[model samples]
Target: MKNFILFLFLFFLTNSCFPAIEKPDDYFYAINKKVSAVVDEPEEVKKIYTRELQKYKKYRTKKYLISSKYVELSLRKKDKHILVYELLKLNDDKYDYVSIACNYNLALQFEFSSPELALQFLNKAIQLDERSGEKYFLPHLYHQKGRWYYNKKNYKKALFYFNECLKNLNRKETLYVASMHNNFGLCFDKMNNTKLAIEKTRKAINILENKPSKTKEERLFLYFIKGNLGGYFFKLKDYSSAEKLLSQELNFYITENYSSEMINPSKQLFELYTITNDKEHLKKLIDFLKEGESRLKTTDRIEINKIFQKYYAGINNLENLKIYSARLSQLNDENTSKTTQELSETSDRLNNFIIKNINQQYAYQKRKNILLTSVIFLAIITFAFFILNIKTRNKRKHDSLERQKMILENNKKMLEKDIKLQNEKIKSLYHSLNLKIETEKAFLNSLKNIKKQNNFQTEEVLKDLLLKVNNLIQVDKRNYDLISECTLQNEYFVNRLSEKVPNLTNLELKLCMYFRLNLSSKKISSFENTTPNTIRVYKTKIKTKIGLDRETSLDTYLKTI
Candidate 1:
């Protein structure tokens, strides 16, 4: 009985000392932490957002749920627009701003279904934020409203909301500040304030880069800013700077298979290449364009046509050049015609709205009895007409959606095709490179034999042959060629090493690069024109400076990087 009582006491004490494990669905405050993610299923989403979110209010999860899946419910061709409606039904005095965020999110998802619906939700978000007496989500609410106006091309109004976003963002809110600066940059770009746009984008980049930990979305924003910087540099006619930024972005996009975002960067690079007379890069640009021709929008095709126009002209191929020029002109003409047609349709709609409103007012005052009878009789006929009109509109929308889906599907296929072509080209280039190297070796061998056959008397002939061989076999000039190429190739390795060992000199940096390439002590010594013993001393110094122990494999560590 004593033992049992003691055991029960111990168990209770242990339970009191350590808190219970948090359930997966338990609510947790992310006060100082970044946002958490959303669940995938609708039932979970409803339980979390519709019920749990309202229960905890603004002090709970600031974003309610951070899922791109929830965002995607707003896009696409189908007509399921229930997310916002479901969220709006949760509005109450206690959790006003929480409900407000739901409304804004709903607006964002179905902004395409109706502009009025989006505006209605946006206004509700603002109103709820004002009434809640908490600035918890005011910045985010302002940002979303800015986006709405920005999408509508209302630059001034967008700036108003963006400025509001900035005011609420304290210095410690680096994420919000970075986002605000980024959107402000986009606004400035759209308004044609190129200088401000560049400044804002660079500010955003600086802010995000300073953060110790960045999410994938933050890194993507950095990539986008770099690409935007490239565009701005292109506008300023700084081709060299533009080429560097755009090329880095293009390389990332191609390697990561981000085909949707590749089009503009590719076009910008093409423009830079055309002007710089870089036929090698220009040929690559042409390949990318041709491979994506079916997927290109009017603007994309126009840009590509311009590139071909320059390429053929450079080669003095007049016939092909003329053909491309005609295509370019045709694309431009078609774009203009489409723009005019859209404008005409918009004007007709406005005129019809005005006339119908005036007739409704006049008929009510001028002939009340007759108008009433007519409205009653026409109501039945109008109901049937309304049903038919809805059917027709829905069918048209469905067809349009199908076309869009087909275009995207075709784009994916084209991207895959281009990737295959690129791989083949790389293989062919590798073969050509090997052939060139072999030919150079044979040529050098021949030179040696010829010199020997001539009794080796001609110093000038021997000197010329040696110089050509030195140019081909660049290891002797290791600092100039091998180290530079290695540095460019293993950027992450170089960057990490520099950060770890900031005091490293130029020679020490070279030692690190050699280590990164898994070069032996003897090979590194030979490259540095030194003895193996001297190379060992350098390696020890590097390992010590980088805080790695003797047993740690420096080369293996670099390989992981």
Candidate 2:
């Protein structure tokens, strides 16, 4: 009894002196902290994340539950479809915006593949943030929305969203800001604002280059921006600077074995070599191209083959030129067919998704109507029992229910109309794509026939053949259907303009319609795949033809007409 009392006393004394460390039931947060610390090292981040995921078979917190699955799904190297479906399955409507990880990530997955779908996800995230009154992720979300517009080729909208993104940022000197500038450069480049493109890209490069202890991702981005700056220089005919920058980029990509990235620098260098007649560099680049032929995509292969054909033609190598010409024609046909098929499949998927959404909404509406009816029945019964003599109250309640029913009916009709319009748009787009494919096939067949002609062997003959192909393609006529549709929507604006000018060409009429839509010269150039300066010259010609004074605004005048 004395020894037992002594042992109990010792145990109690020891427990009081040194307390045990308590482990958290929700230990995933701790693992998350560690993962964040080593995020710059992808391998270590993956290892730590995998270990924590395996250790925790079930997460105790909502945020970690979604976050862990996000990490796991990302590590699996899944495509956008699988990522979207899996992440959406994990989303709970009851959870707060901060607790859900799928919204932003799913937006990223859809950004490149289906920008329309990506916009919906981005808008959902923004809505959630607004509902929660939280501005923490607003900047990132705005940046993503800007990317969505950028992918859709709506540079003006992209710039608007990017400006919003910058406005929300707490710090201007960040990787995100650098990324924004890089995006602005790309947008400006597409708009044929090469000088502005160079400025923005240089700003991005300066920001990244000046950062101390740069991360691997940042360094890679800097290389990409430099390569893009080189492209801008190439556009400006600054061959010396372009060659220097592109060479460095090519070396970086080669060392990293980035096959897809290799194509851009290679393409630019090939063009530069052909222009400068640099046979020495051409031989070296040709070797790289030959080695990487199997890895390049069909479209890229076609592009390089054309370059080779041009290079060989310049050197009077008839045999090699003919070989490349044949290869280019065949590759063009194959790529056209493949692209057409892919577009058809994409259209089908989009239609199915839209139809599925409509069906879901219809079902939801039916359920809502049933529930509303039940509530009204219960309310009427209660009113009857509580106020049997109050006929006015009963009448008012009945009128209110009728109004609600009318509102629901109106909403349902509007939704149906919207669905109809959307389906029509999809069908129109599909038809246009098919039309383009047919036109390209015709153009390619014409080229093949021209090449087979005995008279096509001379330089002048080849030049004439290219000019004939250019005339035969009828690019302006190809876009006429789209313009016609726009005209119909704009109250026959094209027809009205043609009547008013009486001397307007088809292209000038199209330009007038574009101006009437309030499109900028930059936007018009992008649409026509021409330079802004060329578009400006066309604008001048239109003003002269329309008999407008120099002081009058052409776009504003067209809008009035």
Candidate 3:
């Protein structure tokens, strides 16, 4: 009898172990049939059909949780038929508690999507979830409702919901609370309450830093907050502080290597450099801007131009100002057109998401009965499978981590190599410049010596030529006579003038003597022994050789020499 009982127990266990498996084709056909039936119905009926189809498809695909998200959208669409269908389907399922949970979620999605329907869905979801003892969904529900109100520009309602989300959030779910804080800060910033915005954003950053799961999105948000804070300081003209914060944010974006996040910091740097009149900073900023412009779409050109305009105006440089102004005008026109196009695209996406959500919700409602009956059975199998999967996943993750470490090591080596090369190139250029400068200095010294030798020869040649001229005109006789007399005389002057101007010769010497006496050219030419014509010719020759004007008195030139 004990052996018979054991056999019976084994049989029961084996039977329970095998889960009911539906074919993918059968599941899809049923969903398609339901969707077709809804096509000819009224808007409310059609929405119900779409939701049911999505729920069924989701459940059959083992994506019930994701599908139920559509039901919330249907609620947002305000189709009573779809909501009633969801509720009816929800009530019929005891095992498919997830479907019921999804009903509340769909209600939240509905309220989140439309402010006019928000309060109704918010109360309904709270009541339903409270009755079901599923309080975990309330925080997100409240947060979503608040976001809807926020979108409608109802700051008070939005703050209340956000506060509720925060109150309900636990340490394990702190990231959600941090996200809400960031949203709150953004709302405050939009309202122009910078102090409140700053406080809230700081709170978010503090929380995120303390959290174990710090995501890239959270870090990016922090950077944005830093940028905004920098902007606030910049508006107050506290340039030094503004620059520090903006630079920190810019560096953060660079470290992350996110091109999109780099744009605002780059623009801020451009403005800061302009205000400070720092040419080196401006050059860096311009290079960054040009790089961004090359990568980003044309739609971003207007923002680029706006930055350029401010940069130009801050410097008050005429050439840049004109170029930026023209660019601004062109980009403004282009941006207006692009804005219209983007608006249309956004509207289309909103419509598609709405339709998809409604369909998913309805299908989830339809699959409630089957999923409810099988959930516990599936849960047991899923738990066992998950345990085995976790071990395999962990091993794979370990390998992946090792590979990533190796890549990072290689990257470090490349960076070090680049730095070494740059240092070597700079040293080489410095040495080359020094060598070139030394060579130029030696060459200039040689040219200087040549110029000095030429000047000396020129002077001696001029002196000898004057002596020859004196001999040709017999002025040496006057000089010899003067030397023999030993008289402190006009005789020395007479001899000197004879040597300087000797063609006439005596008459010319008299003329030159008169000139040496500080007489004008006209007065000198009137002296005895000299014809005016001969005196004029002597003066012309001296003027030509010495590069002096004939009109200048010889006494002046002689005194200078």
Best by lDDT: 2
TM-score against truth, every candidate? 0.43, 0.47, 0.39
In the range 311-345, model 3's lDDT, one tens digit per residue, is 65565555675566566555555555542444334
Off by over 4 Å in 3: 1-131, 149-154, 183-197, 231-238, 266-283, 313-561
User: What is the total number of backbone clashes in candidate 3?
Assistant: 15
> Candidate 1, 343: how far from true, in Å?
22
Order of the predicted models by TM-score, top scorer first: 2, 1, 3
At residue 115, candidate 2 shows an lDDT of: 68
Give one digit per residue, the lDDT tens place, for model 1 in 1-561. 122222322222111111134432122222111122332244544444444345335444424433222333323236445644543443333345346556655665556567678788768777876775554456666766776788799998998998897897566756567767867877888898988988998898899888899865566556766887888888888898889888887777666665556667776887788778788988877887677676767876787787777777678676676677667766766776542444334333433343344436675355555554555556556567778988999999999999999999999899769545643443444344445566587777877788578465578666767766765555334334434443455465567767866677878887876676556788678657899999899888877666678899987775444
Q: Write the per-residue lDDT of candidate 2 for residues 423-447, one digit (tens) a residue.
A: 4653454456556666667667767
Question: Which regions of candidate 1 are displaced past 4 Å?
Answer: 1-80, 90-94, 110-113, 170-173, 288-561
> How many backbone clashes are present in model 1?
1
**lDDT for each candidate structure:** 0.63, 0.67, 0.57
Error of 3 at 27 (Å): 16
